[model samples]
Target: MSQVMKPSTAAQKLGILLSAAPEDFQQTPISREDLDALRENPPQWLQDLRRNGPFPRDVIAQKLGVSNSGLARGGLTDPLDADQIGELLANPPQWLEHERSVHRKVVAENERLKAERARQGN
Candidate 1:
């Protein structure tokens, strides 16, 4: 017998928002096999989500090249689609730009620290 899990668990495994999922999907408990099948051979809805997105906050942050905190500070708490992300990239808002800069600086600092640690052989 297949093991079943909560919708939220399935959504986490799928890297999607449970609320963003279809109503039926939100209501259903998914099996492990079902999750595997979805991963292995995604349906049209999953494909569309992966491609077009109303992506999760983490994905949004990654796409925007900023931290999750930056997104929050920029007042982008809601999920964002690919088109919306694209629009932001094309004509970034002041907050977005600032956040991107901050992200870049943070990344650079992390890289620098990593290199320093490597050089110290520790």
Candidate 2:
């Protein structure tokens, strides 16, 4: 005779299956190495879009799945000026603080190089 499965056992098996499923996985944060790579060699699409001008900060922010202010503060939009960079560095939006820190480091390096070049009269 065929036997019926116990509800608890069925539930446990379902839970196990769900947990094992790749589609049920949660997203992890981007790693610093990955972000640095992007900064060093931004994708062709991004370059083309940025050539026109900074994409609308809000739109780019939405595409990146972050808030507009976060994108603005992270220097991810395009062609940010010194004043904007200063404001961002002073008080970054919450979600992008880590990424912003990385960007800040890059910007600082760029500034240091520029200053050194100026000092050398190059």
Candidate 3:
């Protein structure tokens, strides 16, 4: 049996949103030949995506200086290009700031709890 690639993997490799892709594109099992063709001679859309990414969540979060959970809380589900991430950094909306604040608070609380637990053990 030939190796089968998941759409999620393709999305990660292509830097395109899986939801944005056509159902056939997302659902099809790309054979090794098809995979090579996609890489060697990509469609215009794929080429555009390669040049300008619909970057993965981790990349976006790092660019935005926010945690992944903060990103989700800020309601940023769609993939973003560098420009978009830059825009958020330049002028963060209220929700983005709020989510970052919440993330900081959560981290502080976790640290405090950990210290308390250590103290109780002693």
Candidate 4:
């Protein structure tokens, strides 16, 4: 024979269990003074440049070492300047995609190794 517990009683039991760990409790309060200071002295325009859209198309093309016409054909006409082009060349999107693909392959290999180890009881 089993008794059906009421929702309120079950909730109370759960609350008791959760409240038992006083040592595990922590508090993190944001300081109003710090927030006020941040509001007063905001970040510089150059520091927040990413808020602007992607660099100009010609700049991206230059960094990629291709002609502006070629880049325009590839649908990248954002109008980046010389400096932005240099930055883009140093950290190209295609390089990021390649790195991501490599990461996925490594993760898959690790998962396969883990499964094999589990099967072998190691």
Best by TM-score: 1
Backbone clashes counted, model 4: 5
lDDT per residue for candidate 1 within 54-103, as digits (tens), equals 88988889999999999999999889999999999999999999999999
Per-candidate TM-score against the hidden true structure: 0.83, 0.27, 0.54, 0.27
lDDT tens per residue, model 2, 44-119: 6434434433334443443344555657565574644335545655766665666545656766899999999999
User: Which residue pairs in model 4 clash with each other?
Assistant: 56-78, 56-79, 56-80, 57-78, 57-79
Kindly give the stretch of ten consecutive residues in candidate 4 with the minimal lDDT sum: 17-26
- lDDT computed for candidate 3: 0.78
Expressed as tens digits, the lDDT of each residue in 33-121 for candidate 4 is 43344346634432233234244443344346555555655556455544655665677677434544555676689999999999999
> Lowest-scoring 10 consecutive residues by lDDT in candidate 2?
17-26
State the lDDT of candidate 3 residue by residue for 70-105, as single tens digits.
888888998898678778889999988887777678
* Candidate 2, lDDT over the whole model: 0.47
Candidate 3 has a TM-score of: 0.54
Q: Point out the worst 10-residue segment of candidate 3 by lDDT.
A: 13-22
**Who is ahead in lDDT, 2 or 3?**
3
Query: Which predicted model would earn the best lDDT?
Result: 1
